[model samples]
Target: MAQQERGKRSRRSILEAAARVFDERGYDAASTNEILARTGLTRGSLYHHFPSKQAIALALVEAHGEALRPPERPVRLQSVIDLTLEFARRLQSDPLLRASVRLTIEQSSFDCPPRTTYDQSFEAILALLQEADRHQEVLPGVDVQEAASTIVGSFTGLQTMSQAYSGRADLLERIGIFWKLLLPGIATPGLIGHLRTTLPDD
Candidate 1:
C-alpha cells in the first residue's frame, strides 16, 4: 500500500509539472527537460513513467478527463447546466487539458484525424449528448448529430476563450452566461421557468 501510494504521488507530481510546462509552452514546443526541471525529478525517473513527451501528453489528456468524473449522474436540466459549467471550470483550471485542446485544433487545421487524446474527449462529450437526449432535456427539433457538433464546437470555443484569459474571473462569468443564453431557447416553457426560478444565478 505504501509503495502504491508513493508511486501515485510521483506520477501526479510529474503530470502536474508536465501540464504546467505544456501550458506555458505549447504541446509541440514543450520540452521534456522543462518537465523534469519543474517536477524536480531525474531524467531516468521521468522516462520510467512516460516514454516521451507525447506519451506524457496522452496521459495528461486521459488524466485530465478522468479527474473530472463527478460522483452523481446529472438527472435534471439544472444538473446538466451545472455539469457543463463544472467541465468548463476544469478545462480552464487544468493546464494539460488546455494544451491538449489547443493541439487538437492545430492538428485539425492540417486535415489530420483526431489523435487518441482527442478521441477520448470526443467520446466523453458524446456521452454527455446522449445523456441529454435520454433525459428528454434537449429541445424538440434539435438533431442529435447536429447538436453534438454544435456543442463540441461551442466547448472548443469556450476553452480557447478561457485560455486567453487564464486565471481571470471573466472565464467562468462568460461560461455561465453561455448556458443561460442557451437554456431558455431549448427548454420547454415550463422547464425554462423552473430553471430561471431555481437558478437565478445561472
Candidate 2:
C-alpha cells in the first residue's frame, strides 16, 4: 500500500511538473530533463513511471481534466449555465489545466487525448447530458445522442481553445461565446428563457 501510494504521489508530481513546464515553454521546447527538474526527481524515477515525455504530457492532460470534474449534476438549465461558467472559471485559475489544454490543442488530440483519464472527463459530461435526458430536461426536439455528442464535441473544442489561449484576458468572453452559440439551439424554448434569465447579468 505504501509503495502504491508513493508511486501515485510521484506520478502526480511528475504530471503537475510537466504541466508547469509545458505551460512555460510549450511542448516542442519542453524537455524531459526540465520536467524532471521541476518534479525534483531523477531521470530514473521519471522513466520508471512514464516511458516517455509524450506519456507524461498525456498524463498531464488527464490530470488537468481530473482536477476539474464537477461534484454533482445540475437540476435546471440555470444551474447548468452556472456549472459551465464555474468550469471555465476553474480552467482560468489552474495553470496545470491551462497547460494541459494547450498540450491537447497543439497535439490536436481530441476523439482521443494522450491519456485514458481524459475519457473520464468525456464520460463525466456525457453522463450529465444523459441524466438530463432522463429527466426530460433537454429540449424535446433535440436528439439526445446528437445533443450529447454536439455538446461534448464543442466543449472539447472550447477547452482546447481556452487552454491554448490561457493568458488572454478575454477568456471568459470566449467561454460565453461558446454557451451563447450552443445553448440557444440545444435548450427548449422554456429552458432557453431560463438560461437567459439565470446567467449572471454580464
* Model 1 per-residue lDDT tens digits across residues 21-108: 7777667677888888888888887887888877877776656556345325444556555555666666656666665555556542
Full-model lDDT for every candidate: 0.64, 0.67
Residue-level lDDT of model 2, residues 1-202, one tens digit each, is 9999999899889888888788877788889988887889889889999999878776666666655455453564444556556666766667777677667656533333534434555555666666776777776676766655665567667766655576545556676777788776766656665554223555
Clashing residue pairs, backbone N/CA/C < 3 A, model 1? none
Per-prediction TM-score to the true structure, in the order listed: 0.78, 0.71
Please give the lDDT score at residue 186 for candidate 1.
63
Query: Could you tell me how far off, in angstroms, the CA of residue 80 lies in candidate 1 after the best superposition?
Result: 2.7
Candidate 2 displacement at residue 132 in angstroms:
1.8
Best by lDDT: 2
Q: Identify the leading candidate in terms of TM-score.
A: 1
* Clash totals for all candidate models: 0, 0
